[model samples]
Target chain A: MRALCWHGKNDIRYEQVPDPVIEHPRDAIVRVTSCAICGSDLHLYDGFMPGMKSGDIMGHEFMGEIVDVGPGINGKVKVGDRVVVPFTIICGECEQCRRGNFSVCERTNRNKHIADKVFGHSTAGLYGYTHLTGGYPGGQAEYVRVPYADVGPVKVPNGLSDEQVLFLGDIFPTGWQAVVQCDIEPTDTVAIWGAGPVGQFCVRSAILLGAQQVICIDRLPERLAMAEAGGAIPINFEKESVVERLNDLTNGKGPQKCIDAVGLEAHATATIDSMYDRAKQAMMLETDRPHVLREMIYVCRPAGTISVPGVYGGLLDKVPFGMVMNKGLTIRTGQTHVNRWTEDLLGLIEEGQIDPSFVITHRVPLERGPEMYQTFRDKHDGCIKVVLQP
Target chain B: MQNAYGNHSGSSRAHGVARGLGWFSIALGVAEVAAPRALTRALGMDGQESLVRAYGLREIATGSAILRSENPAPWVWGRVAGDALDLATLGAGYRNQNPQQQRNLGLALAAVAGVTAADVWCARALSNGAGQQARLPMRDYRDRSGFPRPPAEMRGAARHLSIPRDMRAPEALQPYRAG
Candidate 1:
């Protein structure tokens, strides 16, 4: 089978590997038809995250037909059933899962000790993500073995195209979750950092959820355009003082909700803090650059919510806990609970409330994954999202 | 489940490290439990040997979990967490030690920190399920129609970075946050 494999920092390849076979009763195998390179995947590609080995399969956002199933699947899914496997690998029956905290599912991450040590607990297994999450082979391959099939894979309607639903696997819900978690009120003003795929989704979702104003921050012209297309007020962070602009826009109250759609690899444009973050990251003194985190807190209205939909790994450096506490701000974040919103989001999709395909700027064969990985990571050639057909 | 966990090259190396750390943890735990006074004296703990003994028991428990579980992620993770507490306690009492004793304690802490990194690495490697149970029975599959896939006629008809954006939302969307 052909799959995208990680070789090292910035080294991804399309290689032929052995086909996947079911190893558990509740597992299913999907022949990937459509998959996308997530902004988070760049963390691995850039070697910002750890625990990746050469030849590890890569990808998480995907949807396709079930090529095989395990006996334990119990007919919840079967051969020939087209499905979109959630990035999370879960046992739907766990207490955490029952409570809607699917990202912390106990049954999926067999190697709980890793996350336990880092985070004081384990997170749910994720497909083709990092070892911190479960190291399930991602959906970028010709075939991927999906564990907990009864729980994670959502059935798709025949009328919709792969592009419309693929983000449901990760970014769509991530954007949706990022917004709703902010506890939005109709009269509130929301400010989002980054206009990438997830940020765009947040723009759309925030508007859909009733925010009166949505402001998106980014330097990329195309992404800013998309954010505008999604009905957001665009702010070029490089050209404008975000704090001043946000303050001026909101009558000095700042934004009621601030979202960090850009995560660890956020670029610094000659700013002193970003320069220091870059220096520290290069020296291995810090694992993550929390510039956005600090920026969010700095500009958020007192008692406003700060939401992170972006993917950050390892420790945050010098977080402004004092400021957060003094201002009574609430911090809300987590990996997107991919399955939790699948049904409702699907219903929204079915009702024509949204179309998610506008985020895709490029579609290539699975063979082009390695280069496209670079394309997406470098943000070159006007690329915002890349979907691959395997 | 095997398909999910298997075939990664790092798995065995990680499991090996996990196992070694497990045995090492047991040995350290036993020492703490059996020779708490001597250990304390060596580290200049000021006769607080009982605390060392408690920590030793914790090491033993962590080691036991690493040894018993096929994927020792949770257990080894505990040791990494413990290392912080251990370091914090050591640092808190640094003013009480003689120069030589302080050096010895520093070396011990450094060693623990290094081991913590390795333990974290190994635990992470195990997250790929090298020695873990992830098996399920298999059956062949054919095909089905759904939103995740374009129609049969449209399959492989995609343009470079282009899609049918005009369609409604996809048939399936999965979340990764709520496990």
Candidate 2:
């Protein structure tokens, strides 16, 4: 099988590897029809996340038809079932899964001891991500081996195209979960940072869930324009002050809901804190950049909710915990329990209430996946999203 | 896709060249700093070792900035400026040198010229690729709201969906309104 493999920092190659086979009783082989280059993948591409070894297959957002299934799946999933594989692998029987916190399902991470030592407890296993989860080969190929397949893959109806449902695997549900966790009220003003794909969805999700106003902060003119299309008031942080503009939008009270969609690589050149983060990160003094986290803590309205869907790998530097404590802020953050929301988002797509495909700005063959990674990471050609066709 | 914003396809090449030049600058700077007296003697500027050491420090700083920055275009331009300073110093040393020293100075001038070309090329390549993002023609996405209805009508469109209890904010933190 031909898959995009990570060689090292900034090196992804489309090369042939041995085909994946059924590995467990609940495992299934999926013939991937489509996949995407996610924002989190850039973390590995830039060598921020630890535990990535040479030749690890790279992807976590993909959808396809089931070509084979293990006996444990039984009638739950069968051959020819079209499905979107959630990035987080979950065992349906776990306590976390029962509580609908599939992202922290304890039984899924094959390397739980390592995760236990690092994160205090292992979370869910993820495809094409770091080995701190499970070092599962990902779906950015012609095919993939999905573990705990019966529990995590969401079957999609035939009427919808791959574009409409592919994001159910990650970003769509991720953005949705970010806004939902904020518990946005009808009168609330939601301020989201980063106008990347997840940020764009955060914009629409805030509006759909009835925030009085949605403000998106980013430096890219094209991304801000897209956020505007989603009914958000765009704040180009490079042009104007994020703190001042967000305050003005909320009548100087600050937004009731704040989200950091930018994660570890938060455009390090923009602000003093971001520049500080860059210096710390370059010197290996800090493993993650917390610029957005700092801004979110500083500017969120008192008693407001801060929802984070962005991925942060390790220790962050100079986070303003004093501000968070003083403001009585509520911080909710985690990997998206993708399966928990996909069924609902799929209905939204099926009912014509929302179409997830609006986020895609570039589509190309899987062979061009390497260059697409560069283009998407650089945000060139008005590129907001790049969906790879397998 | 390629556009006036710059060729996205060649972005990797530009980045690779920029990174390579950054490392080269650092290596050359280390050599000059470690052996400033030798460099001055070779170029027939024996008493100017401190000046050579200062240029070395400048090179190290510029190279460090280039490697550290998310966007290295401005730092690459800094390299171009440093390259000019190197050429000027070498040009000044070209006079009043013995034949062997003069020959070594000419070779040094040629090496600096080659690196200067690379610095300029990398600077422009990095700039042309993404430095104009703010000034580029904004691609309009106003019609792509992803809503079936107009955005105004789509407000609270998913209100019927229930929020999970654990995901919601505490009632104590909820905003209160006057009746």
Candidate 3:
């Protein structure tokens, strides 16, 4: 099989590799039909995520048909069933799984050292993320082995197309989780910190959940425009102070719910050291999120909720504590539990409550996975979301 | 009533009742202090720890359901305990904490539970200790080996059950199906 391999920072290639087989009883082989590049993939493209060697296949967001299923699998998902594979490969019966917390599944990536040896250490058992996710080959290829298929592979609803469900694997659900965690109520006001794909999803979700006003903060004209088109009030931090704009818009009370969808790679201006400092702070929250958390405290109303659904790393820097203590706020954050909500999200899509395709600004072939990674990473050519067909 | 030893029979009965009341009071006190910590520990360290803490405080206002004698502590504890069990087993990096921190959290939870149990025990002993000569409610020791779910419907299960919204609307899903 041919797979797109990550060689080094900004180095990805389409190469021939061994075909994947059912390695475990819970595994399934999926023939890749469509896959997309995530903002996180840009980490490798920009040489930020370490440990990438030559020939590491990269990609996690994908949808495909089940070409084969391992023995002992019987969840009514069978051969020929179209499925969307979740990025986190979790065993359904583990302690983490019993509580529906699959992101940190014990059995999925137990041998992190060995897997990282093969893929990368930044990910646990991601499909194409190199060493980060057990270095298991990714779906940016002709075929890929999906571990814990019964738990990881969500059966695509009958009527939905692959493009609609593609983001379900990561960004869509992540964005949704961000909004959901904000605990937004009817007539509540929300401020999101980015307008990327995940940020856009957060904007739409905040509106869907009945926030009376949604303010999207970003510097990209295209993304800001997208946010406005989606019915969220747009704020360009480059032109105006986000805090001031939010204050002016909300009459100085601040938003009731705040979400930081920007994660570690936040955009900043030349003069403001705080934005760069905040990005570093955002990274620390990857393990113990304190920086963005503190920012949420500053920008949110007292007693309001803050939700963080951005992807983060293990180590981070100084976190703000005094603000969090004073605000008497509720902070909720975690990796998105995609399996729990895929069915309902599918229902909403079918009902036309959300159309996620608006985020897709570019479509390329699987062969261009490497190039898409660069374009999406640089945000060049107004690349918002890139869908790759195999 | 007359005592065989020529002591006042009413005094003997009163003394016996008082001793039983003391024992009941002590038992209640122990339970009140122990209950919250046990429940929190069982739930593991996650969002549930905070929830259990809030519930522990609320138990004072709403009164305790632990005194019902059918062993409701495990159910309450299970709601929180079950939340983190899987993460514990998965070798989650968060669980790879400094051993001291892990132990400290455990001790804190135990202390909280112990305090909760003691409070309940004391209240029960003061109110109903003399009237009923019932056995002190025993702690229902759960087998850590087996997973625990509450016997009754857990409050706030709906909130905990919420999944992240990554899946797209059915109409938006068309692209993936495109060959």
Q: Which one wins on lDDT? A: 2
Worst 10 residues of 2 chain A by lDDT: A267-276
Encode model 1's per-residue lDDT on A80-110: one tens digit a residue: 9888888888798889898778888987986
Docking tier of model 2: it is acceptable
How do all the candidates rank in terms of TM-score, highest first? 2, 1, 3
* Runs off by more than 4 Å, candidate 3: A112-124, A130-132, A268-271, A274-294, B1-179
TM-score for chain B of each model, two decimals: 0.67, 0.70, 0.25
Which CAPRI category fits model 1? incorrect
Q: How would you encode candidate 2's per-residue C-alpha lDDT over A1-390 as one tens digit per residue?
A: 899999999999999999999888999999999999999999999999999999999999999999999989977999999999999999999899999999999999999999999999899999999899989999899999999888889999999999999999999999999999999888989999999999999999998999898999998877998899899999988778989988887788999899999999997656667766876787899999898999989889899989999999999988889998899999999999998998789988999999999999888999989988887887777789999998
- Report the Cα lDDT for candidate 1: 0.79
- For residue B9, model 2's alpha carbon misses the true position, in angstroms, by 4.4
Q: Which is the leading candidate under DockQ? A: 2
Listed for every candidate in order, the interface RMSD values in angstroms are: 18.1, 2.8, 28.6
lDDT at A244 for candidate 1?
96
lDDT tens readout by residue for model 3, A1-390 = 888888776688888889998888888899989888888777667566655667877888888999999986785578999998888777778777777666666567745776455435322356766555566677788888888787778887768778777788888778877777666555578898888888888876766666678888877777887777666788877677777788888888888789888765554221234433533443543333334444667778766677777666545555555666677666667777777667767766766556577788778778877667766775655667889888
Q: Which ranking of candidates, highest DockQ first?
A: 2, 1, 3
Tell me what fraction of the real C-alpha contacts between chains A and B each candidate also makes.
0.00, 0.73, 0.00
Task: Give per-residue CA lDDT, model 2, range B49-164, as digits (tens).
Answer: 89988888888778767765668899999999888998998998788889999999999999999999988888888887765454656667777888888777899999889999
